[model samples]
Target: MSADTQMLSEFVFIYTPLPTKEAAEEMAEALVAGRLAVCVNIYPGVTSVYEWKGAVQKEAEVVAFIKTTRKLAPDAIAAARLRHPYEVPAFLVLPIESGNEDYVAWARGQAKA
Candidate 1:
């Protein structure tokens, strides 16, 4: 199916944090280059605390908000895994049931499904 005509099942927003902006962009670029994701927005200065090895740790990370079609979720996640620094990265996908139709269309259109 043509990428445009390809029906985007729904929207999914994937998120993961990086230690640095460069690293964050690297993951984004890789996904976009491979057509796994359409866009990724990086936000700095996020504090994260989680349990690791039965201990609580805190760190500052650059959060990457990835926008992509549902069909590309697996590829997008795989791309992130390849670029993520942490052995266990915080990758979460949130389905977008409702959003601006036009904007969603543009987002889906931007991706080469």
Candidate 2:
């Protein structure tokens, strides 16, 4: 809330998978159109490797980089949850240190924060 604040915001990266790419595309559209996010980069064909229950696991996932303000985080999470096929989607938020003024403005404004 200052002239030098530089429009602080958060970008939430969500990892999910669907039976069809259509579902993924639909999710990306819904979030951006609803203004829950300024932009959503939906990356398909991601192979993820991780540990689960003390065992290693690997799978395909689509990563969605959702850009928005901090205030809209809840709404963004909800939207992703509603559309994601996973019982528990990977929702990780990255705080933006600084960015272009116009882009940051749009992101923060869209977030509804």
Candidate 3:
């Protein structure tokens, strides 16, 4: 892997769906305050379609994009599980391969391993 890739491998984007914008905002605030995430961007008005309890369901939800280091991912996930209302909340983590150097550095600095 390249230097940038290696550097970014330590970073991740965690996507979590909440029942409401208020829930998303609350979780985001907690994650950031606890230093579990460098940043959390809440996107409201998201439509989610999935299978649950052996049935397909569609609902309006809010998605939170949580940015953090891989080292802190577990804590971030744990926090989400505790705060999320759904019995089976969506907690997906995506590896960040590369990004702007300044932003990456800032993120790394903000989210210490």
Candidate 4:
């Protein structure tokens, strides 16, 4: 079977903003270790501008792109929340509509328990 046939709509990308690179790395390791995610790409130097508590807020943060399957999305999200420091964290689960067949299959295999 093709990668699409094997894992289409089965993968997801969880986007989360962390206070620092250390936190992002820690969460990434936890997710991979728990098998909740296959891989997590961390990007630092993110400038976030948002409104919180009825006021605008701006801060520098790191972004983590967690790769996992739909089956583990909930667990992964919950796990991430536990490690998050913010009062309200953003765990955006975005679907992988399409991707490299091999890469997709590999991620799917590694992410599955």
Q: Rate the local accuracy (lDDT) of all candidates.
A: 0.83, 0.70, 0.88, 0.90
- lDDT of predicted model 3: 0.88
TM-score for each of the candidates: 0.85, 0.75, 0.91, 0.91
**Per-structure clash totals for the candidates:** 0, 0, 0, 0
Best by lDDT: 4
Per-residue accuracy of model 3 over 13-97 as CA lDDT, tens digit each: 9998899988998898899888899999999889989888899999999899999998899889998889999898878999888
* Rank by lDDT (best first): 4, 3, 1, 2
Alpha-carbon RMSD of each model: 4.2, 3.1, 1.4, 1.8
Candidate 4: stretches off by over 4 Å:
1-7
Stretches of candidate 1 off by over 4 Å are 1-9
lDDT of 2 at 56: 100
Which residue window of length 10 is worst by lDDT in model 4? 1-10
Q: Compose the digit string of candidate 4's lDDT tens values, residues 35-91.
A: 999999999999999999999999999999999998899999999999999999999
Clashing pairs in 2: none
The better candidate by TM-score, 2 or 3, is 3
Q: Output the worst ten-in-a-row residue range by lDDT, candidate 3.
A: 104-113
Q: Tell me model 4's lDDT, rounded to 2 decimals.
A: 0.90
lDDT of 1 at 13: 87
Please give the distance, in angstroms, between residue 70's alpha carbon in candidate 1 and its true position after superposition.
0.9
Residue 39 of model 2 has an lDDT of 80
Whichever of 1 and 3 has more lDDT, that candidate is 3
TM-score of 4: 0.91
